[model samples]
Target: MAITSAGIGSGLDINSLVTQLVAAEAQAPTARLDRRQSDLQLRLSAYGQLKSSLSSLSSSLGNLKNFSTFRSYTATSSDSDVFTASSSGKVSKASYDVNVTALAKNHQLSTDPTLAGAQFTDVTDTLSTGTLTFKFGTTTYDSGTDVYTGFVQNPERAAATVTITDSSLEGVRNAINEADIGVTASLIFDGTNYRLSVSSDDTGADNSLEITVADDDGFTNDGSGLSLLSFNGTDNDLLQNEAGVNAGLTLNGIAITSSSNTVASAIDGVSLNLKTLGSASLNVDTDKTKVKTAITAFVASYNAFIGAVNQLTAYNPDTNTAGELNGDGVTRSITSNIQRLLSNPVGVLGSDFTILAEAGITTNPADGRLVINDTTLDKQLNDNFDKFITLFSAYGETTDIYTNFVSSTDDTTVGNYAVNITTLASRGDLVGSAAANLTITGGSNDVITLDIDGVSASVTLSAGTYTAAELVTELKTKINDNTDFSNAGISVDVTESAGVLSLVSRSYGSSSLVDITGGNGKTDLVGAAATSTAGVDVAGTIGGIAATGKGQLLTGTGVTSGLIVEITGATLGDRGSIDFKRGYAEQLGNYVDSLLASDGFFESSTSSLKGRLEDIADERTALADRLNLIETRLRSQFGALDALIAQLQNTSSFLQQQLSALPQIGGSNSR
Candidate 1:
């Protein structure tokens, strides 16, 4: 008979034996793989914690790495009803007396009351179709004669034109409003007639409106039809409801005028918002609250980072158990570098505060956390606040006031470097060879095309007869108001000397270019023959080594590789030297950046740990395959033993049967 199961024929527990043998074969290797996997997982987790804590610490260094963070100032006004003030950057701590003399107003114009017959009877009344061009200028109106004595165009404001298509009174108003040309129009009904009221959106003396109508009825300015709305800086067709004027004020007994109610140029770092006509006392002071808060936050962040590291690398002597990163070389190196940076002195020039210790910041030896001495910090803030800022931020100073330190790269070396200038920056100019024509006629000599600083634009001058000064103002206004020039921030200044007109670019350096390309009015405005000249960049040397120049920016070479400075003064030759220094916060921030980069220590370490874990999984799979083979072989051997035992029993049973039969026969015969 064939043995169906391992111990069926032999009556032995072969299945249990095979199971125990297979488990014994797999136990030791599987346990080893599991232990290795668990350790690698713990290491990966520890690295994640370290990376997270370092990121937090880097974030805390933002305000401490820049000098501008400590340049905050507070401004206050004694009387809020009159004015309110705010300050920024570095401002002197002082008090000033302010007196408001007059408030600014917007210019408003309406249809003349005397022209009652020209008024619209209803909102839907038909208006003459024509182009209405609005020009911005400063108008000196004489009320007694109802005539404008002088008009000067504002170069900063561009002229806007509105075309009337709907022709209805309401349509005209809507069309003007939709233009969005810094002007608003409204229809007002007063008892008998409806009149259109137009107002300037800005409040300034030079922001006045002079509306000129190109009537389709062949009457340009006859005080009838579309012409009734024409002012032209001299017509009485439009009534002046309000005059545009500047806001006048006295700051510390000195008179000041501003186009808007908010005045910023009167004070160095303070902006005064005028509310009413009154006096108020203005006070400016340094604000130290933010600095103290930043310091406290830095301390807290530093301590938290230290605590995370301690937990990640902890060891229990009694249990004989060590933390995941207990003896990790990378962790040790990171902490050591941080400690070294914190203990090093910042080489700040012209200041006694060269380290964090001078500002009452020190490291705790026991836990490697930062500790602050409040009394010492308070004294530093009171006495040398600026110096304290330089100690913890990237700072630079120049010996000459004209040479200003702009920026530097990480490759730039610290310490002083001498600055020597070979040439000063200048702007491009075009001068006229002969006297210019003062009359500009439409469709003849009114348009001109120019290329200024690589930007091209076409300008159309207004048709009129003007004096030399008026022509200068007109040229400047037309050229500066061109769409391309205004958008690109390119401008030119026009001046007249003995009937000759000259144009100059407002920019500096070799790229500053002003060229008269082509136009109908080019010859008339700039004369028959004109001279064009291009600008030149500023040249210089730093620390006796040749440097590079771009406009007013002078970049150093050699030891000062990436150092950049702006030269504003014209005085060439020995200008002075710039002293550059990096503080603790900046240094630490750079180090952290390197460690957290894409190919940084954190990424590499984590990747290696994951790779090891995968290898452990592969090894466990191989061990399982071996155990399966061992189980298969043990079962086969036990099955053969069972079969052999069964066969032997069968043979013995047969022999006993035969022997019994023979013994019985012999006994019977003897009897």
Candidate 2:
């Protein structure tokens, strides 16, 4: 009988045989595909690590790429008890003798009912309902007489009004405190009755307080009801506790005054904070430690980046093994390009200092790392500090002091660019046709409205102004003090020559404009037939190419594209030339940025590897399908062979049984 199972039919193990044959057919090709996929994956990982190292190096090179990072200064004061100082930007290195004469003080006033003998009993005692208006200005007073003599309203501070919804004393105090209008109000008790004290938030001679009241009792300054709070140049219902005063100081024997204790305008790029009355010597000098530290950081980061490259492309002969990116053409090219760029010299920076090697920064031949010589570097920094900075930072040197190198973009190249100015920039001005009226009467010709730089504001000049200088000063103060003009960063310079007044906008360019719009004082202060003219922009060229001009800045085009320079001189001809140089840090930083970009070296290499890996996976799938077909065919062939053998054995058994039956007769006959 033939067996039902595959191998049992012919006494052969066909299932095991088919399995062994399929494995043999699939082994070589499948292993090959798997090895290819693994190699591609390793290469992709190496590229990622290399990208990370390059990015870290790029970030570290940011500060060193700019010249401003090396222009740091330190201001040291001999005695900090009297004053402390700090400096920034390009400041002159010099010693200054500063003497603090006095500190700034704020104005304080208190309601003294003892003069009138009308003291309240409790905090909730009702005063009167009315509006209290606060104005800021300068005031002159007679100490012996205890009376105010004159007042000049400061245009910088706007008047603030507070309403008394609650007539109680404590209620008025809370309301005044909540106004937040540059003043603080509080209730003070001097071991007796309580008094309300109000003080100015600012400390200056021009920041004195003047309180006026619109009382509900129809008397604004009669020392009755809400009128008791009135204190102005004429009325003194409140007693003055302290007068506002400016800080006084002498810088280098020159007298200086500031509204606050922190003074910033006495010296260029330096700020001084006064503490007490005394003397101190201040010295400003270049900070060298910061420059050295920046250079050291650049070296360390470059070394780390090169170390990653070395490991990624290294071959270990001891184990007969190599790295994933070993022998890669892209990797080799990157290394060679970096080395070439480092060896090249910067020519635009002049001959004395150009290359990193001149500044004691040399590369190691054995390990491909940066090595700094401490002694040599210190000598270079001490001897040629400015040249040392130009070695690793982007620097520009100009021939003319007035024509400054403002800035440049990455697209700007190294070389000299000549500057030429066709027209000088000017500011808008309004000149009066005749002399201004000296006398300014209140409610008749004291108010003036003006339009400056497209902004409009009305300023009320002080009445009773006579001298030409005083009128000019008053006009400038009132016009600059307007909130509308100050908020928009617009101002005007007022000057009077031969009794004629001129108003010029502080800003330059075609957008700068000033005009007398409307007011009763328009015809009196600056005549009705005044001339108004708008400013014109500066016109110039750089590197023989017509540049775009806006105010004082001039930008170049063509080969000198992205280069910018500022023309501060009034000359209308050839100004000078700017010698721009791209240092080592800038060149390397740009190169690294290109290599790590989206369409750059690392991205392209990793993408190709990923594609190859995907192809390997497809090859593995095809191999699996081919192996499955082969196993099916082998099982079918083995089953057929086993059946054929079983059939032959059955036939032999039948024949043997027939012969035995026939052979029994022959054996009996032969016996």
Candidate 3:
């Protein structure tokens, strides 16, 4: 058997040819295996992609399951009962009376007039009697004794606002009022010019205005004869007037006050439908419409779950192709479990209304849509609304079924459904717990009660003097010492003006109460009348001398003029103590603290769930990175196989060419 090369020689060399073909055929199995491996790799790659997507989706849904919104409603007879009681057929409504009360205190203004004795005498002065001069704030004006009959016509004199009556007495009174002087004057009209008298606008000696008369050719001056009137007692202290501010109203036993004139500003329990006379109350109603809405939501959620399941199972009737998850054990398990959840009994209020079917909801297996029997539903709502609510709400014993479904940690439980598309799209997460507390304290002779917006507490002191300064100091100290006080939201401060003392709370949202007791106790030194027996008096005198006064002595004074000493324990009147309003500030403080803790939304649970979602997102990012690495390796392997196939084809072509060129070497070439 001779061998020749011409594409490995094709004709008549039976044994040799059979050997070569047999060898080629033997290599075919390896190539076939490689092809099979490649095909499998492609399928596996697709499967891997689908699985990754599903897993990612499942993780996302898991995060959504933790969402506060999704899990906000828990199955229970309470929610269900209220809903059922208010619902009629498809609609459910309920009405509740709510009342809000204002915790603010009333403020009043008053006047106190008490002064020592002071004397004044009336002096008769006529234009012919004398020339008078008035001085005010570094400005001075002079009036001649010539009876200045036509002075009103003089532009230069007019600049001084001078006025004169026909009689000298009346002229003086007119002059006082017109001169813009800080004094009052009147004339006792006599046959002659008149007797003029003047009074200081202020009550005490410090406020007394002086008048001087100068003798002139046309006037007679009574220098020593002039005297002003006398007064005994202190000036009046003006109290604040809070009247005509606004009237507060009570709604349904709730006290509501508003700066606004409308009734809507008063209550929150009911929405006020404003009318011409008053308002109409609108309450939540449980009617057929509402019931239908709730049912619809449930159905939509269920359908979404079914759709997700179908997608995973690759149930594509259009293409007649099975899905990536076709025949998957996990998919089958999920579908079966979900069906169980829909038909399972929810133990609510010990009623037979355990499943949706019992509540007048029927499921159609053909299309998987839940249909509601309106008449039956209405009967249930009217007769046993509470039972219906319990069935839907109660998870274990009287809670919602949905709650039980998502809350089930047991993977094998009937309600233990897998993470689904809805949960992923909704971004649900679980909530966590965190809280804080606040406290406030008042000072001696001080009564401090804080009502935070609506929350109130009181701090009372025994009878004593609660000076504005001391109260301010104590408030600051307490706020600094207690973190909860700041967290709860009260701010404190002090204010002083003229001779008055005031304790102020910087925040105004909440109210607090402070009371002072035993604040009245005085040590002996100055007369017992001088000092406050209770809280420290910042303005009281010691030993008959001004307590705040220093660095001076009454040398020329009588025996009472020794070095001034503070009456250590002199008692001021019972009313001498200071009182502060603090409750409002405390309330405000607490509110601020709550706001900070609850992320300003007032829902701590929701805030906690959001935090969990953030963590899940981080996990998904890490998984994606790992999947990318796997894909890169698969791409590299496929590239190598393609290059090897190209090389094998080229070698076969070269061998064939060589065989053709070496033709007929062993067979009948001589012809």
Candidate 4:
């Protein structure tokens, strides 16, 4: 920009010359960089398209991998008001005539029917402070001995109880609620006197209340004060409706009884919730619409994926346009692998159905997308859905195995198991002497802690004088009534003849162990034996090799892996060998999942493409920097030329002025 006249002295345009030189230098390199950047951008866009296409394909495969995708059962009830029925695809096409008999109800008892219309003077009044004993069923006690007879008792209920801190009619209800004894206590009144009422939490015949009075004030159902709340079998002081009964229903003329109105076991994979008493015909059939929808969706996804890939890889010479990823190796590999998977049959051996083509799904020869024939698919589902389910889902073959085969979902490996029962599983039990000679000085001093497996619970005995048989009966009730012990499946049994006391586990597995630790007064009843006995584990062999045992399940460990099965019945010899077969859907789903999961083939392909794009960007940046240096050098040379031309022009002017001053007639005049 500074004043310069290089052309004035040299008789040439110096600025124009420099500008032309720089333009020539930039022209080839700039074009090359532009083409390289455009290609890199196109490749990135192509990869993006590929990623989108793969995601769509993967999403479609998800439906195939689902276990319930093959379920085709539809259930309809003739009388929806009585009960609504629903079923899964596992249910066979059948019909059942269901008739509701009687619904389940909870045991409800109230104070004498005559006293229902009475009003209490004070609801918060404390009547007595004693142990509120809730004994259920007819389990007798022999006070002549020191401990319980330990014989068969009724099925244990939530017979747990709490100390009688408050004895008001309302206080009693609150205490019963806090005890959580699977029963509810409330007061119902019609304005005269408040009458106490007790109800069971669940609707079942076994759940009933038997309140016995044993307080500190020597109260033992004397019909005075808090004794009004006590009621035994012989006592008729309290009157109410009959005990609760289980719900009764007839399925296909077969009788069924359930503790709740909602019955699921009556039909496989079907739930029947009964309302009013009525008869209804339940029909179950295939849900063809849902199956068709899933199939169509998968087909669409496959088409979309293939279509996107084609757009990127296709080259059209006539149109004079090329695809973004034309001739790209990574894109070609992705397309080829997917095409190979689609073309090949899945699970080629031991299967009647092996590929999508076998299931009436075929590829279009032109576009390489999937297509389905609805009529053929409908026929297959109508014929036998189970076979269709096996065609796509992974299935296990259990020949003659016992011990209730739960399931094996951890790993997928075709396996075989040779069964062997070294010893039958057993429960842990503790037997004690008869209750004919037991002694109890203080009930509070007899606190015992019982642990089933690892679940521990504590219970304290009543603080009153008790006969030997009574004390033993109370101990049995205490142990059976504890929520933790009962939930852990620990029960009590007595033998009056042998006077044997024993503690046992309900389940026949190692996880069902039992332990009992007693303090002071409690120790004297069980012979001061505070010890633990472990439950037994099933012993078996899998695949002709010793298999590791966990409770009742036997799984392959050393020689083989991923082989698992359950054993219940303890036979001396082999139960049966299990064979697993992978169906078409199972094979395809696994393969597709491999392509979509982290570290899968598609992931590697994408990562490689992304890496290349990064390298291209770096190359572009380096070229730009080199071009910048070239431009700077050209500018510098031009700047020097301009300055030199200005200097020469100034010299020419001074020389001309000096000549004009020395010569007489050499100057020329111009207007």
Measured against the true structure, the TM-scores of the candidates, in listed sequence, are 0.90, 0.86, 0.31, 0.77
- For residue 91, give model 1's deviation from the true position in Å: 5.8
Full-model lDDT, candidate 2: 0.84
Whole-model lDDT values for every prediction? 0.84, 0.84, 0.34, 0.65
Which scores greater on TM-score, model 1 or model 4?
1
- Winner on TM-score between 1 and 3 is 1
- lDDT tens digits, residues 453-485, model 1? 999888898877877877887788888878899
| Model 4 CA lDDT for position 308 | 87
**Least well predicted 10-residue stretch by lDDT in candidate 3:** 419-428
Positional deviation of 117 in candidate 4, in angstroms?
A: 10
Residues 1-671, candidate 4, lDDT per residue (tens digit)?
76646465456676677668767876787687678767767777777777777777667666555546665578889999998987863477788999999887776766653432223555664556676566444322222331222222134432355677776777777888888767788877747556778876777554555666666678555555556666554433454444656789999999999767778787887888888898999988777667667667777877887898889888898998878888888678767877776676544444555566666788888988888887777776667555555455555556673644344453646544555667666666555543323444555466767766668778776555544444556666777777877775666543233333456666666876666665655455555543456778777776677877777777766544555667776475767766555554455556666776889865776687577768767876877687678767865776676667778888999999998777466446522
Identify the leading candidate in terms of TM-score: 1
**Superposition error at 283 for model 3 (Å):** 2.4
Ranking by lDDT: 1, 2, 4, 3
Q: List runs of model 3 lying over 4 Å from the truth.
A: 1-277, 284-295, 308-321, 348-352, 372-389, 393-484, 488-671
